[model samples]
Target: MTLFRESFATQQSLPPWEARGVQSWCFLFPLSATAIQRYLDEYFNFAHPEPAPFRFSALAEAQFGCLTISYYPVIASTNKANMLRYGPQTTSWDHLSYNEMYVAAPVLCNRVTPDNLLVDRQIVWIQPVVMCDNSSVVFATREIVGIDTMHATINLRPGRAPGSLHVDTQFSGFKTFSPTTAEGPLPFLHLETGSPLPGGLPEAATREDKAFLEGLFGVIGGVDLVGGVRPTTTRLISLKQFRDAYDLRLATYQAIVASTATHTDVSDLRFFDPKEVDLDFMWSASAEQILSSFLQLGRPGDEKASAPHEGPGWDLVGRQVKIKVAFAYTNNAVYDQIETLHTFGAE
Candidate 1:
């Protein structure tokens, strides 16, 4: 119940932000347990400030994916502070439109047991890097909830042909591999679904889609049982943190936060052909550095990547094999609500 009034802001912003008619595009890829574990150790280590109360591990079928979501007509939930700050007579800019893209890994979270026996567990996606196109969304998400959100330019739209989609991202990044390169907006990544499978029903979910959804959620909602209800909610985990202002190397606040987005009036769920999906890592030193570890790219003695394939389809460079998609799907939902799961350090 702590509303934030940032020092540079003119008014207080309330939480429980609400959005309607949110669209999401998901492209999943391969990942290994070893690589995921390494990522957790380097960036999201939960073993600090004393061991975490929950046990964390990668899914049996570990996979990494990029979620690009469009949240239109978003509003900061009305409350006393928000009402006073922007009274009814003068309030504008309450509705927002923004796009976000982030890399997430599915993980199994188990409650630590006193008898060394697993008791309760849940599946959640651990988000490491989250980018948004709106500066207001980025600042609010980063400062209030610790989502590690940053500003980027995102272009999300549909192609000329029916059932085709394209999403592109650009971010200000510098080459750590070569420090002399000047920092600028770099082409971070691209996702394009050329077309749906030939003669396939665009309205019907395919077997791959069913299996993928089941793997992620353990049940296929209405598909799993007769007269069953579709699951309306999913959970995501984030490592919320703030660095020490003076030291720059230490965290003044850190915690593990969980957020749930409950979907309603869901429609337009569709699955695309994996081969028809094209994902380009593009040439950004910053993107490569952050995503390569999760995707097992540029590793020594790794030879899976080959020369660029024919045309502008899947290509490989620097051992970053742009494998054909394991699955690609799109859906619409209503997104809201963030809750903290664990706290390690705080002011």
Candidate 2:
């Protein structure tokens, strides 16, 4: 019958990933695909329009503002000199890596109906283009290339049409009837085999068969067999009808305000804010410890950090600490942006 029923019947066991995929497909299958596709096309088209400055008052006024930043994590170098001198505690002395970043554009869909459903539905389809080094000189060059990830946030307000009401009623009753056959009064009489009694026909046949025929055509209580006419001794039917009408009106109004939304972002594109908006005693203490460590044993420069020192007792730690902190702050800002877009509306 339905795809859901067919899937349920045919599919036996499913892996977690497969199961989730199936469920997602099932959920989206009923929706208009053309509508969704068009929505996506418009969403990206609107987002990628000539980069112009945009501002949201609510976000700008907030403590975090619209600013987001991120830092790429430092990868330990395989160089022997680096391992001997800094090892795990090298800080800025370690090789630096950077994460990719992007600014987010907000898209709003208002007063959306079934006809307007596609307008907000397309964000789910937008995907990020994947990138990787392919040069022969690089050791880790070849990698899968396609859409790597995306970040999306959606707010929905679902609504329904006006003045629509639905109602249903059920009736169950039993009636008595007689038969003319010699085997008379059986629940199911064989119409062809049953013989008619003498004197034109039996009384049972006359009365019971007549009643059965009349009932079959819906003629009860001497009213027209097809037309409905109920005998009433009260004057409340009009009020009941009014109540049903009001309920329908209320339901339609309520339906207009319902909605669904989703937010998602890819990991590679994740970014965070580097600056600390609020600083407490703990953060100050941590900063002091870091600065103290840097001043006590910091490298003079990147060259010294990368190269071997000749002095009998020379320590190059300060320069490496500064480099590490810079990288850390950058990555932190990038990660903050990612988190903001991910949980942007949560706060």
C-alpha lDDT of residue 280 in model 2: 11
lDDT of 2 at 206: 46
lDDT, candidate 2, 196-274, per-residue tens:
1122212223463444334322311343212211111101000000113655642111100111111122111111111
What TM-score, computed on C-alpha atoms, does each candidate reach? Answer: 0.77, 0.16
Query: Any idea what lDDT model 2 has?
Result: 0.19
298 in model 2: Cα distance from truth in Å?
A: 46
In candidate 1, what are the lDDT values of residues 1-347, reduced to their tens digit?
Answer: 77554344734344556566666665555567888777666545555666556777776753545444454545454334555554564444456677888877667777776776765878776676688888877777777667778788888888555777777677887634575777777666667676655543233256755455455444322442211122456677777788889999888877877777665555555556665666765544566766667766553344443423333312333333343233333233534467776777542
CA deviation > 4 Å runs, candidate 1: 1-13, 43-45, 61-66, 69-80, 89-93, 114-117, 176-179, 197-231, 299-337, 345-347
Distance from true location, Cα of 301 in model 1, Å: 11
Q: Which candidate tops TM-score?
A: 1
lDDT of 2 at 233: 12
lDDT of 1 at 260: 73
lDDT of 1 at 167: 73
